[model samples]
Target: MPVTYIPPEQRKGILESPILQMAMQQRMQQQERQFRERELKLKEQEMPVKNLIQMGNLAKSLSDLGLDPRVILGTKA
Candidate 1:
């Protein structure tokens, strides 16, 4: 006896077209707009964080030197 193979038919909802592609593009644009707004807000607050780091380094040097705080920041005459 020989074996016979027959392919099955695809259902109606199995494939997507151009309309679905356009909907995905719109969703991506909305997400990108929200991300850029948040990035701008974060950049505005970064300056204070940089100032704190500079101050921390100065404090460490002052404690290690065993000298007056004014002498560390002053230039040699």
Candidate 2:
């Protein structure tokens, strides 16, 4: 494929165009927003798992002390 040579002045103009600049900015903002949303989702998922592990540990400790875990956990007998 033959490379089309754009004159330097035209190339500079294209690069400096306001429309292109705005599009680039919007694209960058979109990417950043997506990244932050994904991070938030991962953190949200992690909290539930962490809470479940902590609850399990607490239940085990309570059972070891001969206490009814279901009662402490608010489950029906």
Candidate 3:
């Protein structure tokens, strides 16, 4: 179904209840948050954080050898 466009000037004469507008805005924000959370989850799953321990150990070994441990930056300080 296509929506008929109502000009803003014509739309002004129509009374919109504030509660309905608020509910629509709240629904939009909720959907936006859900979308972002799904994206974050997908990215994290692609490169799981569980590797941190292994990488941190590698960094520590490098540091022990007097090398700069740049991988340490990603680990918990």
Candidate 4:
């Protein structure tokens, strides 16, 4: 492929164009918003698993102390 060299003035004009700047800003904002939404969704999905792990650890600790978790929590086997 032949590389075409653009003049410095044209390059500057293109880079400094307001329309291009606004488009770039909008795209970046949209990408950031999408990233935040995905991050929140992942955290939401992880919450139940985290709660279950915490419950298991608590139960284990209780059993180590000779406490019956099922009875204390009134959960069915």
Best by TM-score: 4
Per-residue alpha-carbon lDDT of candidate 4 for residues 1-77, written as tens digits (9 for 90 to 100): 99899998789888889999999999999999999999999999999999999999998998999999888777956
Name model 4 segments beyond 4 Å from true: 1-9
Clashes of 2: 0
Model 2 misplaced regions, further than 4 Å: 1-5
Candidate-wise lDDT, in order: 0.73, 0.95, 0.80, 0.93
Better of 2 and 3 by TM-score: 2
Candidate 2 structure quality by residue, lDDT tens digits, 14-34: 889999999999999999999
Return the top candidate by lDDT: 2
Global local distance difference test of model 1: 0.73
| lDDT by residue for model 3 (9-42), tens | 8786544768777888999999999999999998
Residue 2 Cα positional deviation in candidate 2, in Å, after optimal superposition: 16
Any residue pairs clashing in model 4, and if so which? Answer: none
- Model 1 lDDT tens row, 10-68: 42333355676678888899999999999988988997898879866886788678865
Clashes of each: 0, 0, 0, 0
Write out the backbone clash pairs for model 2.
none
Model 2, residue 74: what's the lDDT? 96
RMSD of every candidate to native, in Å, equals 11.4, 3.2, 8.1, 3.4
TM-score of candidate 2 versus the correct structure, residues matched by position = 0.73
